[model samples]
Target chain A: MTRLLPVLTVLLAIVALWYAAVAPMNIRQALDMAERGGAVVVPEGSRVRSETSVWTLMAQNTGEIARGYALDRPRLPTPVQVGAELWKTTGEMALRGRAFSTRSLIYHGWITLQSTLFGFALGTAIGILGAVGIVYSRTMEMSVMPWAIISQTVPIVALAPMIIVLSSQLGIEERAVPKAIISAYLCFFPVLVGMVKGLRSPSREQLDLLRTYNAGGFASFLKLRLPASVPYLFTSLKIGVAAALVGTIVGELPTGAISGLGARILIGDQFGTPLAIWAALFAAAILAGALVTLIGWLQGLAMRRMGVRA
Target chain B: MDIEDVVVASDLSLTFKTADGPVHALKDVNLTINKGDFVSFIGPSGCGKTTFLRCVAALEMPTGGTLTVNGMSPDAARKARAYGYVFQAAGLYPWRTIAGNIRLPLEIMGYSKAEMGERVDRVLELVELSGFGGKFPWQLSGGMQQRASIARALAFDADILLMDEPFGALDEIVRDRLNEELLSLWDRTGKTIGFVTHSIPEAVYLSTKIVVMSPRPGRITDVIESPLPKERPLDIRDSREFIEVAHRVRDGLRAGHGDEL
Candidate 1:
């Protein structure tokens, strides 16, 4: 991390230069025609700008801006305009119930979180049980494993609407179970693969040692295999939680409802509220980060309990 | 406990069929271990010595003959908890503390908690590892870890012990000291032991009887009774009697390695 600091700074400097350079060329070219014989090189309907600011340059730098104004786009939004939008939209949303209250985001976020937690729980149990079955039985390894892979191959986003509609037909619409099922579908495969590998991870020499003790299959698993698998299981669980959250949000989109991060985005688009969209996106990300961190904490606790050298 | 024949293997043999054909691992291997006998099996690599020890410990099935311990089949004897085994490597569970590892067999055998506590202390002290019980296996040196493994084998006070090159990975100094200590412990506890090694000097120094094995279709080459006195010390290696037995084991190994020339 110490060595990464200079690299990050260099990257930031390059980004800043690119932000400063691109729009100046667009704005300079736009006004160059108004100066003398310079034909309006930029197409009509492209926003006409007077002066180029460093921050505004970033927004206008897209190649589409160079072609004559046919590709009509908003002029580089001044930082003040963005800031003003952030304040007004956030302020109105906050003041809906009380001053500085984000009741809408809170309620919708709670709904999404409920679905994520439910889905994550379901997925973890299914994955662990599936992995155990696969490792212990040849029939499961041959039959269930291929089906698990096939299930993952179907794009979940494409299946989300079908799942939602089917679940509504089956009367799970108001229960959050549909979103949870979708989350479970997305989160289980990694945990399943990781756990099977972890359970079977102990070396052959170790197994022979256990055999020397006359330990049976169950005793061997309890004494050695289970303890050895703690690290891999927890790592997969953390990743599974994040996937569960993403799946829940995707699940919300198919439902076409007004809740969760997905719902917030939909509402923002319906009302032309970019501020709402950005705030909702930030909130969803923060939620996912929090859930993943929680699993990481659980992982540390589990490894310590198993007496494994971290 | 009365001192008597602790193990008797009668014409034991093992074979397995592989992709190529049937492979014979051990042939007509027979040995007897009486109480307090520190019997050593010495041979070159691929001599099937380790496999023979595993058979006595009930870890492998003998395809041809019977292995009896105190007049019971190895499988029944194992269920009766008649012996403890130490492997070529320590094989200590990295997740367990040394004390916990020592108690594993006791735990499986349903020994009382108090009994386990007492036996853990006794064996740890026997191996001169009195204060190292709480440390995890990974935290210990190779020699110390092997010592812990030996202590684990002795934890239940079984009548017989099987060790497969248990100290082969240790330094010479540690190995010599451990051999002396092991002999003293045997004399004190009167536990019959079957030890396997490849070093001629180690075999000559440690054994009451040595069963030499030949490879490539492993079979017994010779069973030589050591001429060294029942009592052994560090200086025994310098004694004339020790050198005679060492030379005999060397000749036995040569014949086993297929260099009659």
Candidate 2:
């Protein structure tokens, strides 16, 4: 409980700041809306409102500041508005057994999760294979390592659309495939670097001990290197899963997908519903937190079974 | 080489070609370790004692001279699994239980599951770690961890055991206790042992033969054949014969250092 106090405090501070920022951010729009409704707002012209400082306008119209929190299209959604939208989309829908409905965040979250998990698995497999090759062969280390690093440098935002177009041209019917590929592309680098470091983590004395047993290359690897890399692999996996989610979300952006949290965010932006975007963003955060926490729990379980101390 | 000779090194030399210059880690060192013999190499730091042991285990290549273990080259003998080596540190895998660490070599060598279990149990009992086999290395004390490492080396039933300062890191009380346990272990197993240390009393207490050496173009200065009895106790360190052997080793070390000063 004591450990949780600091985190709770920081979260409270952030929420307070978010609530405070809402008034200033949406004040101009709120005043303009009030003027159109026939209320006499000081410095009523939209052009004057844009030119004047939001803080000064806010003080001049204290009565109008509360309207900022109730705007139809807020620049920054209030915490209560976001919380209400999140609950309506997720909790309320879940309670009504409509959690998987088209409008539900859970439905969109499940879509994003499928691609994220698929891409995570693909990236992990490629990463482990690449690490093994790099560790065993000098040629792979020299050839593949540079390209792996270079692959990460090409911005995923730019690459996502190309991948989508390329896969579609290749006659792939599944939209998830291109998204998974882009997700895998972003996640594989961390796994590769981490596994390479992990596979080489055994000490000279440990290697020498294996050598004394006359253990062959494969035997040594199975007995020593593979087991040694587990802790490192898990550490990389946490990072990889989070990156995969980001890649899936970015991939969702350019494709104009009709479902998924990323689509909700894009659609909310296009249709001028900041509340929908805020809800989807929070849902994405919750999903990322769940995925990372799940991996952490697995890591603890594996280490315990392997006889490693915490 | 004699029929009983387990390791025979004549004019064995190892020169490490560092970027700074060539370092003569071992210089024309000559020695013979026979079957069932406990030979300890004692010297100050940089004295090639550990290097020589590494050479016998085929972990290092000798630059010059003929060196053989069980009548074959060190590398060939290594492939035949003729020896088990214990390093200065326990070097047990943290991810494995004590029994599991002992089972590592047996698994690599493709021993049957039942036989591996039997060997692990036997070696754990031999090292007085019978019921603690399921415990991780970190859970055991340093002395127990080293004993478990010894058990690991013994599990394979190799005829030769090469230990490089296996107890160098322990406190004196722990070191003394482990030394006594090790001597009894050596007496029971009758394995040809190559031990390395810097402590004069440790070398005197542990070996049938103590090879004294010096650093800087590292080479042997003396080979003392101990006259101590096979059945010895920890109190033997205070005995006249033990002190005499230790004194000679000290003198040999001083003589090796004579040219340096």
Candidate 3:
């Protein structure tokens, strides 16, 4: 409870500040809309306030402030508005027998999830293979590691479209493959670096002891290098999974895929529905959180079984 | 091809070519360790005691001369699993249990599961750590961990044991106790043992022969055979024979230092 209190307090403060900013941010548009509807309009820049108090100024512009918070297409959606949209898209939409419907977040969330998982799996395999190559061979370490680092510096947004287009030309029609490749590209570096470090983590004494046993290269790798890399692999895997999700979303954007959460966000932006964008953003955050938590659970189980403390 | 000479090094030299300069870690090192002999190499920090031990285990190759173990090349002896090596620190794999650590060499040697289990149990009992098989290396005390390391080395029942300062990290009381236990273990096993240490009393107490070494191109100054009886107690350190042997080792070390100036 004590640990949670500080986090909850900070979250509440952010929500309160968000609510307070809604009025000032959208007030000008609200007043202009009122004027266009032939309502009484206070031109605030031309008029001087009788009292400099904030409450008095707010009282004078109550109707306009209310309209600002309740705008159908706000530039910045209030937390409550975003919350309502989420509830409507997920809970209300599901209750109304359209759980898998186009309007439902659950439908779009599932679409994004498939690509994210595929990308994560591909990234892990690439990372492990890259790490093993680097550890086992001096040539691979010298040649491949620098290129892998250079690959990460190129922005995913710029590269995603190129990858998608090139892949399509190569007769790869499935949209998820390119996205998975991009996700794998994002994730592999951390796993590679971590595994390399872990593989080399054993002491000289330990290596010498293995030498005395006359253990072969493959036997030593399986017995010593691989088990030693587990904790490090999991740490990289957590980072990789999150990066994979970001890669999938970025991959979705340039392709203009209309099925995933990234597409939902792009659609909401085009229609100027801030609430729609915010809901999709929240859904992506939730999905990433769940994926990372699953990795953490796996890490706990594996590490515990290996007698490594959390 | 002498059957009694378990290890024979003739004019063995190892030079490491670093970016700074060539470090002559061991130079023209020649020694013979016979079967069933407890030999301890006592020296300063850079005296190549560990280097010589590593060469015997085939972990390092001498740049010149010949070094053989069990009447064969060190590499061939290593391939035959002729010796078990215990390092300075108890280098137990943290992820493995005490029994798992002990079973490591056996597993690599392709021993059957039943044999591996039986040997792990027997060695654990031999080391007086019978119930510690389930515990991780980190869970045990430093002395206990070193004992576990010894048990690991003993698991395969090899003809020779190479140990490099196995108890150097422990407290004095723990060191003394482990030394006594090691003497008894050596007596029981009859394995030819090469131990390296910095302590004079430990050298005098544990070995049938003590090799005094000096730094600056790492070579043996003198090899002193112990005049004391094989059956030694902890209180043997107070005896005249033990002190006389300890003084010879001290004299050999001092003589080597005087030659440097």
Candidate 4:
């Protein structure tokens, strides 16, 4: 709850900014557009035309002025028009299920969320296990680690489409599996490096204490190594979740047909109405922020339970 | 009990396999510590005093020689929960509360829940930390932390205690208080103690027997028996007998210094 305060404050500020800048300005832009018979005109060298509201003024140009307005450029969405459109669309697309309803966003969001979680979990597990394996065994360090580093350098963004096609070719028919795999690919590296560092975090002196107690391999690892890794694990998991979300979003962008927030975004994007695109983008941002906040809360709870202050 | 000697080290030797060379840390060292014996081993920096204590605690294995306490090897003795070791640092688990830190060995040794609670209470009281069980290690002064660590070791009710410069990290006033408290605790419980310290005054103030040693291939130089009365006062340090023994320890150290080369 304490953590939510800052986020809420930031959100309120953004809302205020929208009210101040986009809300009134976009309404004025729309009014001016409607006034000028839906074509914008910028009276030359007007100081008001030179500010951030320049885009709004440019839409007022007869044909060839302002940054975003042109005979060809997509219209700058006024705050009122977007708000009204958002309200109307929420009624049509979200609340009442008109064209491209928010119910679809919810459904796609659920699918994306499930894949993100699964992929993040799978990646963290793999990374932790791999880190443990590498830390304990010099042989694995020589043989497996370099290849793992090399694997990450390959552009997963480019390979995601190939992975989808390849998964089908191999008769792995799960629709979300390919996307989840790509998310997994994005997540595991941070976990790998972070877990390795965490697992090895126990100082030489702490290990010496265990040694004095005759604590053998597994005993020392469980009592000391594992507990120490917790903070690192949660931190990595937070990063991993964000990366997984990114990977899933990226995965959706390439396919252009899958069911996800990302797919919804791509669909809304091509239509040229910034409101639809902005809504999708805003929803995705909210989801990522919430997910990160959840991980952060867990981190605090675990650290507190372990008697760690921070 | 035919033998009240709780610790017996015979011809102990250790050679470390270092990259630079085989470092001979200890050679043919022998010592016997009886029940309630406050024995301190003091030496130069690279001397085997700490190493010897470690060997006795089974933290380090001897390259040669046999060591036992209460007729058992240190490792076997440790498994039986026979000794509490206080390291140079408090070695308190930073994440555990004071009482929780004290309870660690008891937990490891598998005491009943009730027994563990009783034991923790007693040790916390023993160290004069009657009400500080909930505080973390960082919250305490260095002396208090070390005392808490000693309390942790004392919680086990082991027949033997090993302390490696436990007071070395403390300032003078706290160290003096702890030394007095330790002596009183020793007088009360009759637990055999094997302590390692570099501080001359600490050794003189605490030990029944001081084993003086020196560096290059470390070896015991002299075993000085302190004759100060059992009922020690802070002013006892100013006594002639105490002064004599302190002088003897200094001379022995000087001799050991010469013997090193």
Candidate 5:
């Protein structure tokens, strides 16, 4: 609880700042609405005379500020509005009808999560294989490593559209595949780097000891290299999973898929509903947090089973 | 006692080709180590004592000349599982418990699980680390970690044990105690041991034969067979014979340094 104090304090500060900004950001729009509503006909000179500072304007127009905070289409959603939308979409929608239906945030969250997991698995496999190649073959180390580094330079946002278009041309209609490939593209690099480092981590003495035992290449790799790489693999997995989720969401954007969190964000933007956008953002964050935590738990179990400190 | 040669090195030379130039690590090293002999190679840094041990373990190939172990080439002998090597550091896999580390070689050798367990238990008892089988390497003190490493080498019951400065990192008191324990362990096992160290007293106290070596194209300067008995106590380092052997080792080291100049 004590450890959480600073985090809670920072969160509270951010929320307060968010609430404070609502008035100033929306004050012009609020006054425009008030003028349009014919509540007051303000003379151009009187606007400068009435309020010298934003704080004073805010103090004088509490009703207008409250109106800004309660806007259906806010520039920045307030914490309470976001929380209510989150509840409405995920909790209330699910409780009212089919839990996995179009109205539910849970449905969109699951769609994103499914693609993320698939991409994560594919990326992990490819990364481990790439790492093995790099470790064992000098050619792979020289060639593949440079290419892998170059691959990351191409931004995923730029690549996602190309991947989606190409896949669609190939008659790949499943929207999840392109997203998963994008995720795998993002996920593989960290695992490759971490595994390479991990596989090489055994000391010279340890390798020599293995040689003295007449342990062959494959034997040493399985017994020594693979086991040594576990901690590193899990560390990379946590990062990869989060990256995979981002890739999946980015994949959703260009295609305008109407099923996942990305679609919700797109729809929210189209309809000017800050609530939906905020809800989707929070849902993605929760998904990433839960996935990372699961990986961490698995890492703890594996390290403990091996008798190393977790 | 009629003895059989367990290790034979004739005109053994190893030169490492570095970017600067060729660094001669070992040269013209001729030696015959007999079965059941406790031989210690005493030398200063870069004297190639560790290099010689590595050759015997087949970890390094001699650039010139011949070296054989157990009547076979070093590589062949390695394939035959003729030896176990302990390093300067304990080098225990941190991820494994003491017993698991000991069980490693046995597992690699495709021993049955029952056999692996039995060997692990027996070596743990031999090293007096019986109760530490479940503990990871970091949990143990420096001496205990080294002892566990020794147990790991001893686990597969190889006829030859190659230890390279296994106690070099320990405090003197712990070193003294471990040295005594090692002698008893040697006496019990009767394995042909090739030990490496820089300490004259440690060399004098432990070995049945002390091979003093010199650096700069590392070669044996003196081979002194101890007149001391096989059964040695901790206070045996204070003995007159032990002192005489120690003095000879020190003199050999000094002479080797003089030759380098």
Candidate 6:
């Protein structure tokens, strides 16, 4: 309860700030609508209203300021507006048996999640195998590690379209294939660096102790290096999973891909519905939080079972 | 190659090639450790005492001269699992329970499931850590952790034991108690043991044979065979014979420093 209070307080503060900023952000549109309804707003002309400071216009037209919260298409949606959109698209649609329809955020979120998970699994496998190779062989360490680092510097946004087109040219029909590849591209580096560091974490004494036992290389790795790398693996996994989600979303952004949450965002922007965009953004945030928290919980479970204290 | 000799170092030397220069860690060191002997290498820092013990364990290669263990080359004896080594720190794996840590070497050496369990139980009892095997190393005190480490080394039942400052980090009261326990353990096992330490009294109290050494091209200054009987108690340190041996060790250490001043 004590831990929860601080988080709740901070969230409330952010919402309050968001609500306060909504008045300034959407006031001009609200005033224009009010003027069209024959109400006398202080700024006579739309151009003058655009030039005027929003704060001054706000103070001059207190009655019309509340209208900003009620606009059909707000410039910046209020928290309550975003919340209602979320419920109408998710909970209300579920009540009408349309939760998995094209309009529902859940359907889009599920699509995004599939690509994220596929990429994450692929990236983690490649990363761990690469780390083992790098740790055991000098040639792999010298050759592959620099290339892995260089791979990350090329922007994923720029590469996503090229990957999509290249995969299509190779006769791959599945849209998810290119997205998952892009996600894996973003996911592999953190896991590789972390596992490399983790695989090398054993102290000199620990290694010497193994040497004294004359343990074989495979035995040493399985018994010592692998277990020592668990905490590090989890840390990297958290980062990798988050990066994978971003890569999946970014992959959806290019190519007018009309399925995932990223597509919903693009659709909302094109239709000029700020509420839908805000709701989709919030859904993505919630998904990322859930994935990272799930990894953290798994870490706790593995550590506890291994007799490691918290 | 006497059958009774467990480790024989003749004109054995090790020079570590550092970027600064070659460091002569040991110089023409000759020693013989017999079967069932408790030999302690006593010296100051940079005196190669721990290095000599490491050489016996085949953890370090001697650049010059020959060193043999169990009548074979040190490397071969190591492969044969001739010796169990204890480091300065306990170096227990935190993820494993005490029994699990003790079972590590046995598992690596391909002991059967039943034998591994049996040896773990036996060594835990030998170290008086029978009940604490289920506990994690971090949950135990420092002294208990070191005891668990010793139990881990003994679990494989190697004939030779090499310890490098195994109790150097403990408080004196804890050290004294562990010293007594270690003496009893050595008495029971009759394993050929090579211990390294800087404490003079610890050297005098525990070793059947004490090799006093000097620094700067590390070499043995004196080898004292204790006249005291095999069955020694902690109170034996207060005896006249123990003090006489300790005085001789201190004199040897000072004589090694004579050329420096």
Report fnat for all candidates as fractions from 0 to 1.
0.42, 0.97, 0.95, 0.24, 0.92, 0.92
lDDT of 4 by residue, A1-310 (tens): 8889999999888767754454333433443444456444445333444453645654454243322222121344534445554455444555565545444555667778988998888888889889999999999878878988997899987889998999889998886888888889899999998999999998876776666565668877877888888888898988889999988887887785557878877877786656666656666776899999999998899888778765
Extract clashing residue pairs from model 6: none
Model 3, residue pairs in steric clash:
none
What DockQ do you compute for every candidate structure? Answer: 0.54, 0.90, 0.85, 0.38, 0.83, 0.91
Write the residue-wise lDDT of candidate 6 on B58-78 in tens digits: 999999999999999999999
Model 3 chain B: ten consecutive residues of lowest lDDT? B252-261
lDDT of each: 0.79, 0.94, 0.90, 0.79, 0.89, 0.94
Candidate 3, which segments miss by more than 4 Å at Cα? A37-39, A42-63
lDDT tens string, model 5, A1-310?
A: 8879999999999889989888887665565566667666333234572455656666666666766776767777788988999998888877887778888899999999999999999999999999999999999999999999999999988999999899999999998899899999999999999999999988887888899899989989988999988988899999988988898898888787998999999998888887899999999999999999999999999988888764
Q: Per DockQ, what order, best first?
A: 6, 2, 3, 5, 1, 4
Ten-residue stretch with the least lDDT total in model 2 chain A: A71-80
Q: What is the TM-score of each candidate against the true structure?
A: 0.85, 0.98, 0.95, 0.83, 0.95, 0.98
TM-score of 4: 0.83
Error of 6 at B10 (Å): 1.2
Interface RMSD of each: 2.2, 0.7, 0.9, 2.3, 1.1, 0.6
Off by more than 4 A, model 6: none
Model 3 scores a C-alpha lDDT of: 0.90
lDDT of 3 by residue, B7-65 (tens): 99999999999998999989888899999999999989888999999999999989999
Worst ten in a row by lDDT for model 6 chain A: A253-262
Which one wins by lDDT: 1 or 3? 3
Question: What is the C-alpha lDDT profile of model 2 across A144-220, one tens digit per residue?
Answer: 99999999999999999999999999999798999899899988989999999999999999999999999999998
**Whose DockQ is greatest here?**
6
Report the lDDT tens digits of candidate 1 across residue range A125-233. 9999999899889999999999999999999989988888888898775748888999999899889988999999998768876766678888888888887877888
Where is model 4 chain A poorest over a 10-residue stretch in terms of lDDT? Answer: A65-74
